[model samples]
Target: MVVVGHIFWLSDFGRFAVFGFYILSGYLMTYIMHTSYGYSSLGRKKFATNRFLRLYPAFWAAILCSIVITLFWGSSSNGFILPTNLAAIIGNTTMIFPHWMPSQIEPRLSPATWALTVELFFYVAIALGISKTLKRTYIWISLSVVFIVLSYVMNLYWHARYFSIPAGSLPFSLGALIFFLSKQKSVRYIPEAILASPIKLFFTSFCIAIVTSIAISQSLSFWLMEIIFYFCMAINFLLVLSLAKQNTFVNGLSTKLDKKIGDFSYPFYLLHYQAAAIASVISLGKVASLKENFSLISCMLTFLILFIMSLCVIKLIDKPVEKLRQTIKAK
Candidate 1:
């Protein structure tokens, strides 16, 4: 979904996918912290280290790709000499950037990485308070609501209404609620079909979400502001919870496939723009968006390069990091 959106601009799937990804991240991180890394000081230390190991190598590789692309086959309108620009570069290199930093000042080499910036903040929050999560879950949800409300009231951009830290944390909080939900034997209103066919339900909601996003973006209808965000978010929560709770052969197989694909997703996401840029530079004479010169052949080649580079990064970086992460899990 993210690849298609970024590489082709076919829909708002990339933006919406981040909303869903945060839920998955929050749920998975909460579970692992609960089960494997207890909130002891040593446990927190190990968790932090493991997260750094998981995120940085692939991020750095992507950053390097961005820098090289800028230096050689691309243009850098933002000069490297300004102190602010250099600071942004340093921040990007370290995978540390202030969430409040304006988009123009801290230019994301790949725009998708803005999510990672927001995500990093949450990682620290998780380490510090994942144990208290059930107790403070509503607080997180409330903050998300506040953020979304503020964004809408302020007439901020579409991304701001949903995926900024406060608004974005809604999905994460909702995702974490699944952890609480699974604990209660009495909370049993879930349909068997949803649990049995999580992907089907998810895709149906996902399509609705994409269309709703377009409606919201274009202001095709006014009711979207009041309704669509919550609807899409609730649907994602149910889908993720269904995936988490179900134990059947079909879901088991899907889980295996998810795990396999998830291993590639991070590097693949980070490399998507670079792949498209290279493809565009070849076929269209310069780096450009989907709006520039829509070419099926270029998009196809971008996917090919993106997939190949994603595989290479996994083989070179993520696979090794996984071994180290497993050692932490073993403890």
Candidate 2:
């Protein structure tokens, strides 16, 4: 994934994957919150507890490891520049430094924690009852569109630092809309069936064409490209969800892998960049050089090492934290 990011500058397909995550989040959150568990069952306290368990433990572990690696083994433009200020270290440790105030220390540690900042904001928004008020499918969809537009506007005009809301968020809203639509007993499941149908082959092909065209075209602005990418992502997500429902074989395979990887994905994504940065230092500038053919090989090795490290992190930190949360909630 890191290799793709480095190689294909125009291939922002990973961002599209983030969009798929958003739609899925919306669907799953809505189903769990509104359908399986009553809205009254989830107050702000419960919401905060859930979000904290889901995020903070693994995050803090990754941050600490990254800081240690940087301090000891990391390379510098000149020699090692020790992180001097207590404020900077505290900011990175808390994950509040990049979100509230910009800092030079951001590039040094886990840069991907920026996405966690967006995610934390989303959690706060949902917990505060903002998501609860968006009852209708249309309203949720409209709000998503509005947010995207506002994000673009902020990016274009105001130079808002965090204008590009992670794509994972939109999926959550989309999922909410799906959940709402599913509840209306009168609403036929035919649309979903069609989405799930073999006819999706055509739609998938068309989406591919559109994506290719946009990638080739230099005239489209970054925001416009983002819009196109999200639209394609939504369609692709619908197709994938539909197919998953209808195809038992596919469903079975997906279910197994999803169970294994779903929760761990966040930790993997967050920690992978840190792993890459450290690998680059250890490689002695060999990892980052476009001229070196071995850089690709180094990156692949780095990704594998990071994946193993993330799995260990998940087992050691995340699982224990989760168990502790469950115990507290049970009490």
Candidate 3:
């Protein structure tokens, strides 16, 4: 993921990965909610309670730290302290600021909180019974495509600039569809040879599309690029699911890493931007520009330090708040 971020700095293809993340988030969330704890089991109060516990404590701690940093370091050209207005503060604390306000006012702490805004919106939408209403597999798949197109249109017109939906939303929706499909008893499977062949073909085609898209267009139309991205992500997910079902070596490797990385992934992603920003400021982007042996050394050192700091924050601040939230929810 860090490599992708660095690539994003270098070329446009790197930007597509962000969309991949969003889509994956949507899919995983839907899959977990539906398969593990049936859609009906996740009522609004319970969903909200669980989500709040999972997200808010760490998020608020990060906000508080950002505030302290802003006070002492002062706002940089890109940085702004939290708005003093009660409305703005409340909106931000609740992760509703982006929905309620425009993008002119800078975010108080991490600028990347804007994505969190979209994520929060998604969570709220789910909790409000959007996911539960999908009684058929086709409905979920169709809605995913519809939303992806809608998100693309929103991007094209810039009407809803603040609610930046990541490209990953489509695949995530597809993931939900996959979960729904898996539960159906009459879907019927293809012959083993056919299934294997199509999965392979899908993967090859998906990779070719991604590489071709990157090679040909530096600034492709937003909608066009998103369509290609959705195709690639969907194929990728399908391939993974096939492998998992077949109990292949690749599936075993992926399952092991997915379990470990998935555990740390959220915290790692949440804290990485802040850590990177802090490192960039301190190093003045010197590490970003190194070459040859020094470049590798600098990059490793920077990543290590950032990871350690983030892990510390996760353990000390995030974990405690999580425990507190769990306690409250139990009560």
Candidate 4:
């Protein structure tokens, strides 16, 4: 959704899809900590190391791609600008200053990286034991609520929605709450409404349709839309991740296919702008202006190049990094 929204429909919903990623991240990191990396000192070290390994190598490669594209084959549509100052360059490369800080509005080579800055913040929080105990997790969730309410009251809700480090904890902490709920003793008897994947999918789709219909008919409040989007998308992602645990044939096959496609996600997220730039360069000046003359052919070419570039990064950088991550994780 982020890729489609950014690459093809830049005017629409690409940025909101990142909230779904935050929820998914919270759930996944919680599961990993409980199952493999415990709350011990050594475990904390390993967890932090593992998370960096998971993100940084591909991220750096994407930075390289972005730099090359900006210097050699820049495009106007993807907003690919190389930061001229040393500080901005360092901040962009290390993802240290992608926030909404007024004094530090660093030139982002890849616009998608601001969310990654948020992700790294949560990674540190998780490693610091915010997600360790159910009680602590609840505290984390409470912080999210407080931040949301305060931001809304102060008229900073939308601004804080994506880039405000403190307020952005809403989705991450909500995801942790979901993980903690599933682990409760009472969850063993969870209603089939949520436990069954088919039912989960159906109910989510039905609610979405109902919501869309209602939204079309009348003005639904912004909060209502936010609630619906977060609840629906979080569970939907959990369903996707849980497919691997299912014994059914279709579900099992879906998991296998999902794992393969998942590899493209990170690389594509980081390198997509460069892909667009590359497409623009290759279009023989046809894509001079995305607003007027960017053809369907240009869009498809961007997508194709994105996939090829992502696949190459996965094979060349991500695969070897994965092996090393697994080896370290095994310890």
Candidate 5:
């Protein structure tokens, strides 16, 4: 959905997909920290180290890939800088490029990495609160709500992109809460009928309809669509919760596919904007000019090529990094 929505600009699937990703991250990270790693100082250090290993190598590879694509196929004005623009590249290397650089020059390489920056901050927050999370989950959940409210207000009034931190805090909090609640022996009231295939199908179809409505409203310039979008997004939280509980036929299929597709997902997400940029140049001779929103064939072709390249990266780069992380963990 993210890939297609982005390349074609047809729907707000990218936005929806990102929200889902954030929520899932929150759940998985909280689970790992609480269950796998202890809340002591050494545990926190190991947690932080593991997260760094997971994030940085893939991110740097994506940055390099984006730069190479931009240099070969992108125009200078397309917000990507070459090796000659050392400072811009340096800022990106630090992953704080958006913080210090001007708004125009920010996200010059691997534009999607803004999410990674927000995610890194979340990791720090989780690490700092590991002890508190061990003792009292409620306090962390409260703070998460406060952050979400503040982020929402800032997003409404402020133009800065980093203001997303607070908004993202809410979903992350929800994920943590979901994990905390799911483990409780007393909270076992989930109806088996709801988890049945038919009900799951209904919920999935409803969510799809909501996404389609959001896209239609956005395209038609409806003021109420934002309200609807937010409402539907909130509903999506429940959808995720319900789906997580049940292992359906579809879920089983997805699980099998994720083994192959999951590794490519990160690199694909990181490099896709640049892939689109490359596709534009290949098909239209200009990065900014989109032929009819975007040329479907061109974007798909570019995405396929990027996917193959990402496979090479996963094997050559990500696999070794994973091994190195395992070595560190063993130490």
Candidate 6:
């Protein structure tokens, strides 16, 4: 959805998508650490190693792909910029290009990847046991609220990089809170309808909001959209918790599909921007503008290419890394 927003000039749903990613990351990381590894020194080392293996190999692959695609067929269009030189290639591979390099020189191979920088920082912080200070649910909740408030204020008055730090941090903290809350006895056994109905409504309203805002981009203000987005995300977080334990959807079919979806998600996200750019170049000629050339057919072509590419990377690259991690764990 975030990639779709970037490609199609839809409402600012990308912000919520990134925030949701942070929250999910926080919950999963915390759960894995608490249960699988605990807080031992050796455990932290293993955790950090597993994290790197899980993320970096695929990222390096994406960087290489972006470079090749951008070098031959890249055009700056609809706010998408491609890497052009060795410096960008190096910086993007490091995953710190947007943060460390000067904005003018910083090539946005995939501008959406700036969030990954923030996520990497959080991963390091968690591995170093910075989460020790946030044990109590109240503390986690309070910090989450503070971060969200700070993000909102920063976004109102500050530039992109400045707001991004807090914006990224906010959902991560919320994820920790959700994890803690899930451990409570009272969180169990909600009526299924309480969750299922809202989730259904959320998807419906979210689609309506995105389409309506894009249709009337002139009438929609940023602040108004922000309000709607946050409301949707809050409802989503609630749904995340409600459905955390109840995974069997008609005897495990949904769970298997969900895992497959998860396997493809990160690679798809990393590759989609460049894939869209490549699609534009293919359909509209090398030099054509993205806005002029973009159509339903181009979008479908991009999706097909991205899906196939992501599937291949997951099977060929990501799965081997996973196997290596499991082998190490077994040892």
**Which candidate should be chosen as best, given lDDT against the real structure?**
1
Q: What would the per-residue lDDT of candidate 2 be over residues 170-251, giving only the tens digit for each residue? A: 5655666665554444335456455545345435735564465557455657556655665666575565455434434243
- For model 2, where is the 10-residue window of minimal lDDT? 158-167
- Where is model 3 more than 4 Å wrong at Cα? 2-14, 35-43, 77-80, 100-105, 133-137, 140-169, 184-224, 239-258, 285-298, 317-331
Q: Count clashing pairs, candidate 5.
A: 0
List candidate 1 stretches off by more than 4 Å: 76-84, 101-105, 130-133, 150-159, 186-194, 213-219, 222-226, 247-257
Worst 10 residues of 3 by lDDT: 285-294
- RMSD in angstroms, candidate 4? 3.8
RMSD of each: 3.1, 5.0, 5.3, 3.8, 4.0, 3.6
lDDT tens per residue, model 4, 1-331: 6676565543325544566678778888887888889888999899988888888888888888877776775545455677788888887778777545421364677767877777888888887889888899889889888877887788875556556777558788867766667654444444544545644564564456455435734766767766765566655555533432341424446766868987888988888777877787788452343334468888888889999999998899889989999999998
Report the number of backbone clashes for model 1: 0
lDDT per residue (tens digit) for residues 151-247 in model 3 = 5566555323223443334555555555554454433563445335444745564465657456546766755654565566655555544433442
Candidates 3 and 6: which is better by TM-score?
6
In terms of TM-score, how similar is model 5 to the real structure? 0.80
Give the per-residue Cα lDDT of candidate 2 at 229: 61
Order of models, best TM-score first = 1, 4, 6, 5, 2, 3
lDDT of 6 by residue, 135-199 (tens): 55356557756755765666654234233554555566667666666666555545545554445
Write down the TM-score for model 6.
Answer: 0.84
For residue 254, model 3's alpha carbon misses the true position, in angstroms, by 9.5
TM-score of each: 0.87, 0.73, 0.70, 0.84, 0.80, 0.84
What lDDT would candidate 3 get against the real structure? 0.54
lDDT at position 117, candidate 6: 76
Clashing pairs in 3: 19-168, 23-168, 27-172
Which lDDT tens digits does candidate 5 get at residues 124-150? 777676324534556665776665466
Better of 3 and 4 by TM-score: 4
lDDT for each candidate structure: 0.72, 0.56, 0.54, 0.70, 0.64, 0.66
**Number of the top TM-score candidate:** 1
Question: lDDT per residue, candidate 1, 1-331, as tens digits?
Answer: 7787655755465656778888888887787778778789988888888988998889989878877877676553322122246777777777665666323335666556767877887777877874356778778877777877777788887656554566557777777778777676545777665666677668877787678656766755554543765676677777788767753425346766867787888988788888878887788776666545778898788888888989999999888888998897677
For model 2, the superposed segments whose C-alpha errors exceed 4 Å read 1-3, 6-11, 35-42, 75-90, 97-108, 133-137, 147-172, 184-190, 197-224, 236-251, 254-257, 281-296, 329-331
lDDT of 2: 0.56
